[model samples]
Target: MGRNIKRILIIGMSIISSLAVGIIRTEAAEATSSFGSASYEWMQGIESPIGVYVSSDTPIYYMEMIVTYDPEILQYSSGGELEEEGRIKVEIVGEESIEVSQMLYFVPLCSGTTDITIENVIVQYESGETAAVASTSAPITVPLEEGCALKSLLVNGKIIEGFQPDILSYTLDLAENIEKVEVTAVADSDTTTVEISDTSLVIGENRIWITTMNEEGKRAVYTLTVNRVQNLSGEGTTKEEKTRHQEVEVLREEKEEGGNDIQRIVFLILAGLFFILAVLLFLLIRISERKRRNRRRCRAKRIAYQKADLLKKVRENDRQKEVLNKTSEIEIDVQHVTMIFKREKDEATSIKELLIRTIKRQRSYELFKALDDVSFTVYKGEVVGIIGTNGSGKSTILKIISGVLVPTKGQVIVDKNKIQLLTLGTGFDFELTGRENVYLNGAIIGYTKEFIDEKYEEIVKFAELEGFMEEKVRNYSSGMVSRLGFAIATIRDTPEILILDEVLSVGDMFFQKKSSARIKEMMNGGSTVLIVSHSTSVIKSNCTKAVWIEKGRLRAFGTPEEVCEVYEKMNQE
Candidate 1:
């Protein structure tokens, strides 16, 4: 019985000790799960320095950090969830390490160093326990002075405030002639220095470089081009030499007639002078007649040449018409197409009024008729040209036919033919690289990736952008963009129905000629084409038939010459 009691006591002590150790471990875990300490630092921003960022290692479900700042030295303008007096509450969610940040806005009233403290940091855990963590941020230093920049630029004693620093160049037009232009640049700081490349102006475009450098070694350059026009008139001559020759001639004539019967001698001399003057006058008349006849012969030759050229063009046009009439098929037909646009108008000035008008449907709108029952037919192997003035619905008609725009009341029957619209600068992304944009444009035009891959090198070569294929299109010049667009639209695959809208007018002369030749080749290859251009010469030379639209109405549809003649007469009227 003594041995049993001793064993039972030993077991009881062991159990009690185990229970105490488990309790102590639970307490230690609870202590470790409590809110941890935090530290913060300052970061720079655009308007002001960013405030303290309080970071804690404990996984927190909910947290709120309050930042206390000196109102005299620093003032909060924005950021943080809630702001009241000098305290800001930043609430963070999720079971992760917590970081709370706010912007440190400075008060412009005073500039100095001040302490920004983080206080009242409350962190909550998943066990529904909340505790406050103590933290503080570093002091912020604010500069009392602003940075240096160009404050103003003066040209010829006149301040030019309209010049923008972002524009690297400026042009000044002066109607009055000037030999020199006086330029002065003023900086925000007195420590900045200015230099000018040239002070005098010359005829034509004169480029002057104006450079400004701050004390910190930051430099900015501006180019000023001054143009001067010079006067090219002769000066006046003196008057004394004009009268000496007349007095000498009179004395000589009086001496010659002195010893000879003066009246008879004067009569005889006058008669002979009259005969010589008459002969000279007759020869001058003959020469003038001969020159007039020569001019007429030259004009006749020119007219004959022009007539022969016209006849050749007419014959070529006739041949094309004959071939199209015999071998071509109908491609597109438009029957009484009409389009109208609804333009909404709202004069509401305030947000409240705008909301009220929108909710009550009180806005007014008007209908604008862009096309009025226009009709035309296109055939394969024929080139049709549409000509009209601005706002006469020429482009609108093309858009409708190309399926870019649907008519308001009429239907366009394309007869299952593939059509593509080629316009300058359309269907291009300026931010994408030229190579990527080529593929993108090809995809947009219904070409597959495989086809684009095959034609990629050819497209780049045709555009003359071999080395610039990897460069962004925004960096390209307008002519370069135009060339790339034209090359992509014309190469590899030719659509059955092609619609061109003033695309030929873009780029340089060489590109224009290249594009025109490609278009002619397409037309010759039996692709139906519809073109719109403001150039009458383009219409007369390239098109077999012309359609004239005036103020949303079809005025004439016939041969190019006939339709152009009628359109010209109407414009004259």
Candidate 2:
């Protein structure tokens, strides 16, 4: 019993000693902070995980820390609970001297400097007492991005006018005598190096390239074009020469006109004398021949006169007759017309090419059908519109009606002489003056010289090109050419058939409106008109009848509204 009691006492004392040492350790314990990392440096969009640790010899029940950071600068992306705006609170709990670690994930919102602070740390020990701890911080840094781009570009000591850093192409037109031009460039960053390769200048086209690169081996390239043209009597090189060349020619013509007038008159007098002598000799011979064939000639003349009378009665007549037959007689009749073009795959550019093509037995060619078995009719005084997508044979059919092209498979029955086919970029010679083109176009339309002379000023006034009549047609702006063509084409106040191929869309918006009004007036004034346009609205508004062609075949023909509806639906699909 005594041994048993002694052993029990020893065991109790050992337990008490251990308990006292543990209490002592517990009383002296204090939490120390250790962060996962002291600093973080990374590029944008990289996610990093971090932790805050609290160590102690005694057990810990709970711990909380308030994390403070700029939300705009750092994102506590995923791990921690967002307690509030720009603040994240983390909590950890354990039993025995636990390492209180709360993992946090961070990502930089943008490239800059910032800091993450863990403060207001409260630790709850197993003894049921709360204690505050000091705070810790970690600094974050993101380096600036890298790019290879030019800041400035200079040519011949002059900075390019619009030197945007991102634009990769530039052009410079040098003068006639310029032999070499200095080229320089600067990069957007100091780390990037620029190299230029612009050593030679050719007569026509000189191309230069400026290359830039950064330390990371990323590269950007910029191109510059230098143009030099033949010094044609000292004029504008790249663009067409200023109008001074035309002005000089006009002055020369004026200087020479005075001396040529007398010479022309003298030549005309001598030519008239020779013509009279030749006619006198011809008439003498005709008198003898006529005596022998008088009876036969009279009979033939009677038959010819009768046939002429019958033809005139049945043939389509002038403006007055068109008005009388408005909407009654067919003005244009297209009968089973098909147009095919022969396109050569390999054209002979030289003698060697010709020989090769012949030797190889290569008759490589393509037959393109521009129109196929198309037939339509237009009545007198009806405004007809032809609508089609581009290259769908809209313009081809017009040329067929205007007698500019003969159909390969069929025919168009219309008064070819009365057709006034007005298409943009046609019927004007670029080498001629605008004034000369006016006369030439009028003469081709069957207007006599005297008639054109009487209406010359009216045409010029309508065209609004009075001061520029002497300029070459090539020198006129597109608007000016369109105006001139419109004026000349509409000079006749007759009821002839008029074919307009997108001519109403030739000018600025205001001019287009004006031209549309003029053509509408003509259409309503008993003129049989045919129009080809891409705009369905134009056809719907102006055309009394409509024809739709698609892929070289007639798709629809009816009222404008119905045809346009079908066409627009097809396009939508």
Candidate 3:
């Protein structure tokens, strides 16, 4: 058994050894941008455009830069504007990473190289804050010639001794046995092209010319002079020498044949051992798989028993009493409900990972309490706002009330059928036309076909997409879809219990005003509203009651002003 365990462990280690590693870095839902010196051909006696290039994972809104260059070597020609005292600050905006290039034309003062250093570089990505820095140096140099200068010249795959970009010609002598040589010439800029002549060598000196041309139609040639070594006078091998050479060759062949035989024997032994190990590993894995399956079955049975017991008790004691929520005035009741999610942190992103973790006994899964034993009661015609930071059980409670998710512990008593969760893209079919989706969404909301037909024109007008009804819903932008969804949701008489999750308004400013007025009109008509919003004013002004949740536990529940004042203060601190 111990031997089997060792074999199994070895096999497990070898399998899926390339398990995923590395975490993708991100900054608070903001996209990252980078800046680099743009490469371009710079020639003496001519102004060339060479500056910084910006690249980003997302579109850039704008950028402010300060570039300082060697003034004695490079003089500004045109392009970038001069700012305070000695600063050259340029702004480039409304372009993607591909199109974002800030170029400055500069005339080389002399035949030399100079560095253009960038500082205080700020790249703005979309509507995010404009504080991302990307500072890099761009070196400017005038080549030996427009296209004549070689970054490096190689002979037989090796750079010759005493070589520089300024040195345009070289002479190399080949060995007696060296029949041919390869000459590789690399140009200073990608805009230049290099062409070589025939590389084969003859008995005498061979001169080759490498021609280069730049984008500006300027051309230059670098010459290579190669002299092949001449053969020296030699006497022919004698008959005795030939006989000795034949004997040596024969002995060497015989020794090699014996060595090959031993190698074959060793190879066969190793292959046989590998086969045996593979068979053992296969058997061990199968046994472990069966055991793992049995364990899973037992775990699943235990969970089912727990769930069944919880359901039986919940059915018996669902009608809990709350003082504020009298029978006729009560709209919703959430009683001592707790939500706990069980899974690994990474959650075995792949099937191979799942198998590897299972065999290694890596218990990665753990419970996450999304909601604690919290209770809240909502009375009829009361607009209650749920206030909390992200992942504070606001949405979870809404889901539980809307019957989208059941709590792991405790019970909720409400007419789930009469509840409507007003959210964007709730029942949209992207493939269907906006006109068709209007009917589809209306049907899902329990609206009759005739009622939709009567209200179809009004809905289209409210969505402000009357011209786009014939277009596919997928073709519409996110804001357009939100408008259409909001329109369909409002067509129905307000639900007995309205569940809103960060969708108090939709569309542009004009449409948002309309949506807000419409919601207020519905609220005045006396309908229960339960909303989750980050807006403090929404809770203070719109909601009669507010509930504050912190880390899945209820922190405060009172009149909106009382609840929001403390919640906002805590957040500020």
Q: Which candidate tops TM-score?
A: 3
Please, what are the lDDT tens digits per residue for candidate 1 over residues 1-573?
344544554565455445544433222112111111132222211123343444555455566777777564455654464376666666655423354333334332233345566677777764566665657566555432232245777799986647754444567865335778889877667887777787777677787766666665545555666776443321222244435555777888888778456645555555555455456545554665668768999999899889866865776576555635653476776756889999867578998998898899898899999898676667666799999999999998888887779899656667445877877666789899999899888887777899889888988887888899999999999999999988888875677788888877768898788888888887777778899998878999999988988889776666788777767777789
Residue pairs whose backbone atoms clash in candidate 3: none
lDDT of 3 by residue, 427-529 (tens): 8899999999999998887789999999999999999996899999999998899999999988778767777788775888888889888888878777799
* Residue 487 error, candidate 2, Å: 1.0
Query: What are the root-mean-square deviations of the candidates from the true structure over C-alphas?
Result: 47.1, 47.0, 26.3
My TM-score estimates for the predictions, one after another, are 0.41, 0.41, 0.43
| lDDT by residue for model 2 (273-328), tens | 54554565456546655665688889998998898666545542443355345434
Please list the residue runs of candidate 3 whose C-alpha ends up more than 4 Å from where it truly belongs after superposition: 1-328, 348-363
In candidate 2, position 186 carries an lDDT of 80
Question: Where is model 2 more than 4 Å wrong at Cα?
Answer: 1-328, 350-363
